[model samples]
Target: MTKLIGALDQGTTSTRFVIFDDTGAIVTFHQIEFEQHYPHPGWVEHDPFELLDSCRLCIEHAVNKLIKLGYQVSDIEGIGITNQRETTIAWDKKTGQPLYPAIVWSDVRTQNTVDQLSKKSPKGVDALRSICGLPLTTYFSAIKLRWLLDHVPAVAQAREHDRLVFSTVDSWLIFHLTGGLENDGVFVTDVTNASRTMLMDIHSLSWSNESIRFFGFEGIELPQIKSSSCIYGHIKQGALTGFAIAGCLGDQQAALVGQKCFETGTAKNTYGTGCFMLFNLGDAIPPVLSHNGLLTTVAYQLGKDQRPVYALEGSVAVGGSSINWLRDNMHLISDHHQLNELAASVEDTGGVYFVTAFGGLFAPYWKVDARGTICGLTQYTTRAHLARATLEAACYQSKAVLDAMNKDSGTPLRALNVDGGMSNSDLCMQIQANLLGDGVLVTRPKMRETTALGSAIAAGLALGVWKDLNDLDKVNKEGETVFRSQLSAESTERLYSGWQKAVTRSLDWAEPVDEKLE
Candidate 1:
């Protein structure tokens, strides 16, 4: 009987359950996408119940397939979870019902609330950034939690009755899957997820009292903070009952761990709906590290014994989402896979550059007023030219983040481990390689689902399925494809410089845009 690990990946757009053998190969896998709601401009949400149901279905389906393949349910040594971080949900502690829709990380409905709060703080809005390593922005759970407390009637009612339980998506799923309120469900979140809420002290690795007071969220029952890798609890009942539920990381951090970025300066870019570039900073939090626009966060905490590993992260608010807009909105590309072909049809963008500041630009800029802009459009520009420019937009944004990471860390990245949907496009990857300039290599794993595998690795380590980090080296040893810069430094600079000009034009395009904070 070969033991296996189950990884539950709760992402922004979908939920996936993947079963992995000890060697990190996928035994079986299943994924189900959930609804993404936009009630208003700059607002995004997910039905909490739908998120839970999707996980259940994925798990059941994956386990059934595993059984047909002759693997016993008991062969699952543990279950690991990686989730979209900072998607806030306030639920009834007793009934297990959400008070409001889960506020997604990308939702910027709280921009006005952020502005109001910033004015009240001493260092203006950035007062808390020093403590939380995040700017006062709508991208975190703290302000979203504050907004729900201030606005939602049901959430306020739940709070009055002492039934309000606050959680990120990871905690929400863990609580329900481990028996909800009936079996005294585990009320906890991993440090990686908690770190994104802007409510945790990175150094102490606990909920910050000052932040709680600042947000006026003193009474809600927040989840206990746990290390990224450890047995938080067991599955109370399910297809795989009594399986130890160990290992939990926020999705990007899971990618970092899955990519085996154990040493400082190792980095990876996850080009999902948005892009996140995490440069590992090891155990010590550097004193002089610049938090300017970039965020500092927990990369992972493998066990209680190991100190929490940290990373300097630069987030691009629009990555593959721009590609999504092209397919669904513009109707230019019929499918995502066809995008590469369209992009490759053109020699260049015909001097066009796209600044995909859909909601606003994150990382290194933090320009909340920026909106999408396409510059240098001319008579000769075709759909293929626009397609090439769109791919360039994603790559250029990543390059800006990479440059910032190098400046802050004082060490340049030699290579980047890349994953997610856009990494599948060879043309896009080549563009990324070209724009990133010389001496940097972009590598993609054969099994692109590294986020799920990272969680599985964490769970396996906890249950002794794998002895240590080194023991799992051969897990995903299938050959990898690597891309290096083909463009000269002078040409890369000229192109990226034009991208900067396009970005500047997009800024403040929607200033005084009414914020629906009330």
Candidate 2:
């Protein structure tokens, strides 16, 4: 019997299922995009049922194709999951029904709640950072979970009944797919996802009692923290029923593992709806280092025996999302793929800069007051210039994050493993390489579905598809596209300085006005 591993990649905007053979080659795949709801300004949400249904549809669709390709259902040994982190979900323990829409990672609706908690903290806003290695920001899961429990009626009822189960996307999917609450469902989250919640201790790799108490989640039952690469349970239903549900990791960490950044000092930047640049920090808890306000998070843990890997993450709230805004809101381009062409049509942004803080700035600048801004624009500017500026926005943000990572780790990154939607644009990759300057190479894997592949690798490890990390290196040895710096150091530094000025202009532009008087 041939062996294969399945990877379910549940993301912010879409759900994807991919199947990989023993050699790590993608055999087949399917993707389905779901609706993203913005009920209020700065708020984002997704239907939990929609997310779960899409995964099932993708799995059924993809596996049928795999079967048609001569692989039998019995040939598949396990499944792994990689998902968007910090998206909070709460459901009933007995009924397995979601109480509220999944609060997306980028949603800032809980900013007021975050502020209240921060003000009440004895050590101020930085108090949580000491224990969780995360600042008091809306980016973490804890604030969103609190908002749901306090505001949502069903969630409140579940809490009152002591029947609430709070989980990230991975856990919710796992619980439902593995028999739900009725038959010993696996209500667990991997360490990588748990580390992003701000309710888990970074040093101990477990739920922090202080955080749970501080957040007032005493009655809520959180998922058990598990290693990224272990069998959580078996799929009880669906086309791929009876398969072991093995590996699980937050998307960015899965990208890190997929990029094979097994050693410290290695890094990867994922250009998804939001951008994340994760610098692998190995197992060292490096004193809550905050370079430009970068977040410290768990990278992954393969198994129970191995120590968890840590990472310094620089998050940009907008990446491909900015491009979406251009297409959907601004109507500047009819299609997303047209961005590369439109951008390449121009020599530069014509001194224009776009500060894409559509949902406020994250990482290094945690400037919640900032809003999206376009500066240095004049009659001379065209959509082409705007397109170029849009792509440059991502590159500039990446440069800023990279600078912070280098400063914090004291180890300069020599290369970057790039993935996600925007990475497909050669123009964007070239601009990224140019901005970062010499000695920095931007690499894209031949198998661009690396996030799913990373999860598949983890699942494969448990089933003995591959013995260890050493075996993975030989799995997909395809050639990668390398982008080298083409700009002079002087020019790169000057352009980067302009970006700094643009970022400064965007800050403090949209502070929330208080209407209620104390």
* CA lDDT for candidate 2: 0.89
Q: Output the worst ten-in-a-row residue range by lDDT, candidate 2.
A: 509-518
Clashes of 2: 1
lDDT of each: 0.89, 0.89
Q: Candidate 2: which stretches are off by over 4 Å? A: 285-288, 511-518
Whole-model lDDT for model 1 versus the true structure?
A: 0.89
Error of 2 at 37 (Å): 0.5
RMSD of 2: 2.0
On the 0 to 100 scale, the lDDT of residue 188 in model 2 is 92
Per-residue lDDT of 505 in model 2: 92
